[model samples]
Target: MTAIKTEVAGRTAAPPPRAPRRRAQGLQGSRKRAGWVMLAPALVHAAVFLLLPMVMLVALSFTDYQFLGAYHWVGIDNFVQLMSDDRWRTALLNTVLYTVVTVPIAMAVALLIALGLNSGIRARGAMRVLYYMPQVTATVAVATVWLWIYQPDVGLANSVLGLFGLPPQGWLTNPNLSLPSLMLVGVWQGLGAKMVVYLAALQSVSRDQLEAAQLDGANRWQTFWNVTWPALGPAHFFVFVTSTIASFQVFDLVFVMTKGGPGSSSTVMTYEIYENAFQGLQLGYAAAQSVVLVVLIGVFTLIGLRLQKVSSDV
Candidate 1:
């Protein structure tokens, strides 16, 4: 009433509306609170499980913390020892070899499978489920089955070789064959998940662009390189990073199948860490190895990201 009288008498113009502005501010505040509420659980989990353990690991790396003995600060002694540790070197090399061999093969094969499936292949759903079975299966169970499959005497592999008039080969026992055998298993287990990612990416590719490329007389390979591949950039990066990390952290299969043994031929960094921490009781040294593994993973991931960026630019 006072505002109306003021407006009528022209004594003072009514103030600009404040309610809408205040309401909007209030709504924005509520939204922010809601977002934080939604994120709290994940943030807490990371802090507790990831960040805290990482901090402890770094701290432990500088101390000789054996499980049954008193510990003391050793500065960089553990890292220095790793420099001359032949076992550590062997583990690192084998791990790198495994990662290099498995990741690209897995990605390429998965992408091909995805492309085939995306083309409306018959029984596509069944095929996808079949391929994905290994991924969903327990790693221990998969490794155990593979263990039987790799057995020299009565294994499926040797039987198949016999059918081909070839002698039975020691798949896991032979130093030359152990790592490769593991690589095959790694690639096989990983393919389904990678294929699913690629299939989704392939489906999202622009149909109009593909048609345009076809109309321009581009061959299948040319069309794919120009239209489909570029669109899969995100998928490629995701798969590469994840596959690399998984490869680096591979342990269960080695533990179950090889035990890094017949010597250290099949040993990888993760297995080495486990051996040192548990079998050898060198917790500090194992922590240092863990740190190195983390560093290597970070470096490789960065290299992958850079390569992806360069490829995308090209």
Candidate 2:
């Protein structure tokens, strides 16, 4: 029996090793070639479109270049000048203020709308469409409609205020109110997509856990705080990051509605960049500001991620 076992073991171990090993190596090589082939287009696209443009922008930022003029290297002069530019400083401050104001209010409103819609209300589908319409609408069209609505003399907003015996507001014309007015437009346009996201997140929550909470006599608020909120952690993080970034990059509404008007009170970073690059013909300065914008966005996103981690750990 020992001899039989030894023979069986030897038979199992004695297969020709070189051919199978070579076959595996060949298969691995083929897979690598296939992967490279599949990835080549994307890599080429990044190099040509993204990487090349970034390199060009960085190079341009160091030069005293305009859109149509002789270019010469200035060695951080553009960045140095940016430090003292009052217009740029105001633009930066306005951008930060806009982001701080818009993201929280928009997210809160969206979350509430999602909760209401998710509660199995009648005509929920139509309501969803209605909420989502603003998001899908063209920005230009929305801005045009909002411009009409904000007309202090004959607009719907003033009419509504009149109905309640309240005074009309100088929404876009007032320097102090222009930024907030743009922020409201942004919130309105952004609410629908975020509400849809929250609705989707709410749907994925485990019904069994909710049922168990109810069996344990948990109230709606308690169940939400303990079960629903935790489950929506990922959604919250996503909405926060994207909403913050969008707020920081806000330009369309300002450009369309205000044109950075009312004594430059509504000017934001993106609009500032556009003004420097095209309107003011300071491409190098715009490039430097653009780099700063990129850095700010990256740093803020990292901080948000850290906060999310800390909250999750707690």
Candidate 3:
């Protein structure tokens, strides 16, 4: 009887208060609510602007919408037509070429400039500002400046060529040189931005590892290749992806400089899309082209990520 009474008393002791646990749970719930509240604005903005527009674009790609009148669904006809469009093919090829040429060269030049800036060089701040000026400057302004530089007669480029006894070449007018001339401007414009990214990456490299490499009798190239380059992997991936996207979407320069001419030589995908959408009044076709551009960017990003993974694993 005594044991039973003791056991019943223990059971009826109100079982150690759960108020603390309840309070903790309540705090967590409140925190979650606060987090949601804080995130609401960004979520709403993305929903209304980004997600909605993307959905509209995809929907519009399937219809013959020309910004007026009743539009009928055309299914995949737009995409089918894209497959056979010569201008589309030319634009795609040009875009790919531009991206392929500019990205690596721009990255290399930027990395070199970053290295120079990161070193114990004098006036680095001033140099950095000078290099980064192009990035902050308006694209239209940059394009306009480059237009003057590329003039066939009495241009800076031709004048420099003349100094070396070289004939004055038509930088913008010639079909062969127009694309390359635009590429030179592209590289120059992109350098400052990529350099800034690399500078940040380089600054974060491990000093201890670098010293250890030096102590191990590793030469400059060896230390840099093994230590510095590996440390820059993330930056490399970032620069490559962003540069590729920018290169693929090049337009303002093409517009202000060549206008996709000397027989569509310097025509890019974005320029072609704009021409179709506004000039030709083929919104659906432009939407299809936009879809392709998105897909291409996605593919390139995936490839860069894969390469980064492989390099990291190695």
Candidate 4:
């Protein structure tokens, strides 16, 4: 009877060990399947929208392809040809000039506006809304108003100049002034958004720290440099990078106002791409240019990120 009891106990314990092991394995498999099920929609969407389009673009860049027309593989010929394209060179230079000119000036102005709003001034909220009005305003409406304001004759801009006894000037029509003129519009349009961003950042600054700086005999400018500016690092980086990207991709304003003229004076990368793909019908070459533009944006973005990282570490 004792031996029989021992054999029964052994059998029960052996099955208990194997049973839990089998159940755990099954549970792990089910969890893995559920995870994949959860990710399936996102994966499918990325494949359809981003991955597939990128693949097609890269492929098209290697061939002499047009919209709904016969295409032939041309290898690197298109890319080689694009290297010497004068129009592309001019567009690249103009884009760089626009970015350099607009981004710093806009950021500086936005910071000042944000700082002014943040001060213990009456009607601060109203001022903020007023400053941010341009962001929500329709681009077309803004462009149309700006077009009239830039008119060589009886425009608002000229009228303002006349008040100061300054002569009326050709704003957009002059090649030398065309890019800068468009840049002013760009700065005005983007100022509101950047100001809002900086305002949000300024709110996060420590009032106690600011007060401490004042107690230590620091003036307004010194307090800002030591206490406020460092706190706004993230916002500053974001505005700088985004402003740079927007300047590079400037197309709509050029299309509506300049049409990349006064003879390509204000042409940018995006405008060039549009002209090539739609107007010139050189889809392959345009795709190559698109690839170049993507690279340029990526390079700038990476540089910005690296600088941000370095600043944060410091």
Candidate 5:
């Protein structure tokens, strides 16, 4: 028996066979090749479309190259000029103000609409379609209709106001109200899409968790605050970051509705960037402003992430 045991032990497990190890090496190499193949198109796309343009924009921002310039380097003079201009200052303020006011209001309205649609309402399907319609509607067409609605006199808005014995006050014509009115239209357009997102997120919520809370004597508000809200972190973050970025880069609405007017009161960053680049033909300054817009959005998004942490923890 001792001899047999020694023989079995000395069989050496055949050194665990190098072929298996070689096979694993081959598999790993294949997986690496697969990953590179999968990434090749995306790499090409980023280089051609995104990275190249960004490099050009950065280069442009450092130069004195206007529309008809003999292309010379200026080294941040465009940026300095931007800081000195009160119009750009107003544009920055309006952009920030629009972002701060609209993102929260739009998100709140979207969340409420989601809650309503998710409560097993009778017309849930139709209601969802209704809410989501604005998301698919053409922005120009929507702006056209809103232009009518905001027409100050003989418009839907003023007509409704007159029913309450109020004067037909200027909506888009008043600088004080133009930005806010745009914010309102933006909210209406944004809420529809955000509502769909929230509804999808709300669907993934566990019925068991909700029922457990119910059994634990939690009211609807308590259950939502304790369960639903926490479960909505991903959707909340997505909606917020996208909406905040959109707010910063609001252009089409401003371009269509008021052309950044009520006397430049609605001149947001993107609109300002467009005006500088195309209208004023200050391409380098516009590039500088675009870079600033990018930086500003990045900083604000970072702040948003921090706030989301605090809110989620609570």
Candidate 6:
């Protein structure tokens, strides 16, 4: 009787172990499927929107899809047309040049403002509101105000210059001054947001580090160079990347002020793309120009990322 009981007990234990093994396999399977289910929406969005549209753009760039209601793939024709065209070349150059000039200057001014705001002066709150007001103001209003200021006579800008004994000048009419004038507005409108970002970053700097630097007899400039600036790595990276991208795509101010020029001086890539598609009625060509701009922006974004502490903890 004892031997028989032992045999039955051993058989029952083996079947219970087998049942648990099966249950483990079933749970693993369910987890794997749930993981895929969680990612389905993101995958669907990329396929339907981003991936599909990009694929269409590349295909359309090769074809003559302007207004003929017919598709004819002419390999490299669009690119060839773009390169041979002088106007397009000029517009491309202007875009690149504007990007180079405005990005650094805007970034510097934002840094200065950020430093000022961080220093906690009297009426700091009022000053912060003044800087940020441009962001909340309507674009049309801003442009209108600037137009009045830029007027050659009876304008605030010229009046101020008269106090300095400078001659009256055309801020927007002179091709040389038009781009810079636009840059001034761009700086004013953009600096506030970036300064806010930098202020947030400055607040996070380790107080101990700054105190220790002072204890070591480090001057304010030296302390900022070593501690404060390093803490601002992420904020600097954010402002530079976004402002550079925005600079390349500047159109509204150009449209409002210069309308592409006194000889195409203000015609950046975005404006050119607009002209080619809408005015020129060369949709395929415009798409190709857009492709080039996309590539250029991608290259700049990568460079900006590399310039900051994106990949490193420092």
Tens-digit lDDT track for model 2 on 1-314?
99999999999999677988899999999999999999999999999999999988999999989988999999899889989999999999999898888898999999999999999789999999999999999999999999999999999988999999999999999998888889889999999989999999999999999999999999999999999989888898899899889888988898899999898999999999998899989998899999889888888789789978887987
Clashing pairs in 5: none
Better of 4 and 6 by lDDT: 4
After TM-score superposition, the amount by which residue 200's alpha carbon in candidate 6 deviates from its true location, in angstroms, is 0.9
Winning model by TM-score: 3
lDDT of 2: 0.93
The digit string of per-residue lDDT tens for model 1 on 221-248 reads 9999989999999999999999999999
What is the C-alpha local distance difference test score of each model?
A: 0.95, 0.93, 0.95, 0.91, 0.91, 0.85
Q: After superposition, how far is residue 22 of candidate 2 from its true place, in Å?
A: 4.9
Instruction: Provide the TM-score for each candidate, comma-separated.
Output: 0.94, 0.93, 0.95, 0.86, 0.95, 0.85
| Candidate 6, residue 193: how far the Cα is off, in Å | 1.7
lDDT for predicted candidate 1 compared with the true structure:
0.95
Give me candidate 2's TM-score against the actual structure.
0.93
Measured by TM-score, how close is model 3 to the native structure? Answer: 0.95
lDDT of 1 at 278: 93
Please list the residue runs of candidate 2 whose C-alpha ends up more than 4 Å from where it truly belongs after superposition: 1-13, 16-25
Candidate 3's displacement at residue 240, Å, is 1.2
For candidate 5, the per-residue lDDT at 277 reads 92
Residue runs of model 6 more than 4 Å from their true location after superposition: 1-47, 309-314
- Which window of ten consecutive residues has the lowest lDDT sum in model 5? 9-18
Task: Tell me the tens digit of each residue's lDDT in model 4 across 197-291.
Answer: 99999999998999999999999999998889889999989998998888888888898989988898989989999989999898998999988
Error of 3 at 96 (Å): 0.6
Tens-digit lDDT string for candidate 6 (1-314): 99999999998877445888899999999999999999999999999999998888788888778856676898889989999988889888888888888788877887888788888598889998998898788767888899899999998999999999999988988889887788788777777778788888988999999999999999999999998887788887888889888888888888887888878877888998899888888878888888899899999988988988453465
| Overall local distance difference test of candidate 6 | 0.85
Of candidate 3, the 10-residue stretch with the lowest lDDT total is 63-72
- Residues 1-314, candidate 3: write the lDDT tens digits: 99999999989985788899999999999999999999999999999999999999999999988867578999999999999999899999999999999999999999999999999999999999999999999999999888888878868999999999999999999999999999999999999999999999999999999999999999999999999999999999999999999998899999999999989999999999999999988898899999999999999999999999999999
- Higher-TM-score candidate of 3 and 4: 3
Clashes of 1: 0
